[model samples]
Target: MTIADSPARYGALSRFFHWAIAALLVWQFGGICSEAILGEDHPLAARLSANHTQVGTILFVLIVCRVVWAILNRGRRPDHGPGLLGYAARLGHFSLYALMLAVPTAALLRAWGNERAFAPFGFPIFAPRSPDQVVQTATAIGSNFHGEMAWIMGVLILGHVAMAILHQVAWRDGTLKRMT
Candidate 1:
């Protein structure tokens, strides 16, 4: 089918970004959980934490591209719904985008403040900077904020999934078909 025929569904680029981000998020969350379960001093814990940082950095870059794609492809409509439902869907999407942006943005700031090196595949986000008192302070504050925001994102995601299931099972709507 031509692109126009599937306007309610995501385009090729959008779908790629969506799945890619989803995979990366899973990796990130898994790493976080692993690190928490294992002690910080454990070698496996260190490895998982490092993987989380690297994957988070990749997610940041992918999210930037996705935002640009979303803006450029803004004309494609979402599947139809009641007016209020449609508006709520849009708002939910915007909140997802915001969290996607905020999480990594905070991580980046934490990296900078803590003089932490983000070497993903030998590429660095910034040149290693000298340790600063402010870095520790900022890192503490930013890390707390990041953790809280992550919980918020988790709740929103659960809500989104529940609504999609409701649409599929209760209403027999095709809302989940677009993303899946």
Candidate 2:
């Protein structure tokens, strides 16, 4: 049975989105971090980097589903508690949604505009740029901001995790149970 969301907790779909995205993000950052620390040619880094585009495309799809599901269930999800924490929760979630869309969009735009063919899962999504000319604008945007915005997103995710901990430990609330 599909667990629909209730006033006190998230549904199966919401929890799936939450954990699935969280897992993919872990993969993305693992690749990024591994490349930075162990060099791009290292076996672990190479394997992860090789699948970056495919994983990213998957994440894009998941985010779209997540956004739609969230909107549909907006009224059914738990309320952000009153006062400062609530405001912080709202802002944090908004930032995550915005970044989730923005970061991958930048990469996808670059892939579409650049000379390289971007065929995630062996399906040609974006054809290569003209052989005679190179596109700099979109490539520049992706090169500049894809990693940068992701780091910011990473910070937000850390804050999110910390808040969950606070809710469970300090506040002694079942805030973390909403998704679990």
Candidate 3:
């Protein structure tokens, strides 16, 4: 498969990024759902929670790369098309990207300002902040909005999937084909 995007379809790299990120998101949400349903003390929830931060860090890195790649391929990528639907599509994608970045970033900021060290995959990214030295503003922002923003993002993602299915089955448009 080609590595760069073209007018008709997404290239291999783009598809890789898309699917990989999608899978990671599924994992992330699965963990959240398990914890919510089974309670935090459940074995499945414990298993998933063990790696949540590390997985989130990896996801954040992948997102940054994906955004950079999208920018690089902007002109070469498939067109969004004309009219109201297209505008809505563009706006929707923008919102997704923004939340994708914001969610992890807020988490990271919280970690940074936390009393304990911030390490993902056993690698330290931020050292511990003493109780007195903690950045309360960063901590508060992250604590206050991370979960709320994530739920909003979850809703948007469901809508995104619904729209994709609609385009494929009802509209009979090649929109799904462009990515798949």
Candidate 4:
């Protein structure tokens, strides 16, 4: 109920950011996975893909906000604890944050460098580049790495969930409770 995080547990805003981002990421992945598995023309896949760009844009904005909020609440949040397990936990979290930012950024860069206008949510984000002015480097990096990095991020997310479950069930620790 509190607005700011405490040593014992995350505050309302942090929890909101955490859960909202999780849900949005799930949605984004679902869209891509559906298209990858079912083919783009399939009804379900098509429906999900229809909103992919718009949803990604919204998710990207939310991520930036969440990172800023996390920085603002750094020391007040729950601790990872001492020794090796703690170090692993910290590293895992850092990886997650890095990918969360990187995946969308690469995609956005591609959009920006593409020949077509980049309009997510019907708002013009990037104007179409003229043929001679296209940024091949941005396009190439985005095209080459976005999907690969996303899959890596997906694996990391699964590991993150597994660890949370381990903490809640095996360790019988209050770690999962800190966010929940």
Candidate 2 displacement at residue 83 in angstroms: 1.1
Which lDDT tens digits does candidate 2 get at residues 1-180? 256788889999999999999999999999999999999989999988888888999999999999999999999888888899888899999999999999999998788778999998999998887866667888889889998999999999999999999999999889998879
Listed in order, each prediction's TM-score against the native is: 0.82, 0.95, 0.97, 0.97
lDDT for each residue of candidate 3 in 26-127, tens digit (9 for 90 to 100): 899999989999999999998987788888988999999999999999989988889999899999999999999999999988998889899777788999
RMSD of each: 2.8, 1.4, 0.9, 0.9
Q: Write the per-residue lDDT of candidate 4 for residues 53-168, one digit (tens) a residue.
A: 88888888988988999899999989999999999999999999999899999999898898989988779989999999899999998999899999999999999999999999
Error of 4 at 94 (Å): 0.6
Please provide, for model 1 over 46-106, each residue's C-alpha lDDT reduced to its tens digit, 9 standing for 90 to 100: 7767767668778889999999888877777465566998889888989999999998888
lDDT of model 4, residue 90: 94
Ranking by TM-score: 3, 4, 2, 1
Candidate models: Cα lDDT each:
0.76, 0.90, 0.91, 0.92
User: Whose lDDT is higher: candidate 2's or candidate 4's?
Assistant: 4
Model 4: per-residue Cα lDDT at residue 59: 81
Whole-model lDDT, model 3: 0.91
Query: Given candidate 2, what's the lDDT at residue 54?
Result: 86
Question: Residue 157 of model 4: what lDDT?
Answer: 98
